[model samples]
Target: RTNDAVKTKDAFRNQAARLGFGTPNLLEATEYPLTRLTQNWQLLNSLYRSHWIIRRIIDVVPGDMLKNWIKITSQMPPDALKRFDSQVR
Candidate 1:
């Protein structure tokens, strides 16, 4: 369990580095939820089928997670976040 978490953290760091975002700030956001959404077959099925309760979770979960991720990662040093923002332009 500990090992898996460490590996996940490393992977997220690499991913963030590639996108030129600050690594530290993205740690928590990348940990379980990101991995879970991609890897959980049951959850993915519900999301795809848009099951009633799952539909509500779909409407809120990813958007909320992404918003929180951006909020935290946007706190990068000096003008780092600005530069990252410009890249999306």
Candidate 2:
């Protein structure tokens, strides 16, 4: 499921590029070593704090549900959506 999500995102990015829309490269934004370290540390800390609970959730939760939850929580703003729609069309 995670793989599917990644593939979908990549496909979207590729399509956007083909349509002349520029997508921000998150990796480039975090190119500084200190920034990367901070991000990694935060991820590690979060995992350390909820390792067991996260494991249980992953073991029990359906991938589709998790994907939907992520999408709902990470919705684009109206203006962004409008821009995306215009560019996509």
Q: Best candidate per lDDT, number? A: 1
Once superposed on the true structure, which residue ranges of model 2 sit more than 4 Å away at CA? 1-74
Off by over 4 Å in 1: 1-43, 68-80, 86-89
Model 2, backbone clash pairs (residues 3+ apart or across chains), number: 0
TM-score of each: 0.28, 0.18
Look at candidate 2 and give me any clashing residue pairs. none
What's the C-alpha lDDT at position 3 in model 1?
54
Output the lDDT of residue 71, model 1: 45
Q: Looking at model 1, report the run of 10 residues with the lowest lDDT sum.
A: 4-13
Tens-digit lDDT track of model 1 for 5-49:
433434333654554345444444575534445678887886768
lDDT scores of the candidates, listed in order = 0.61, 0.58
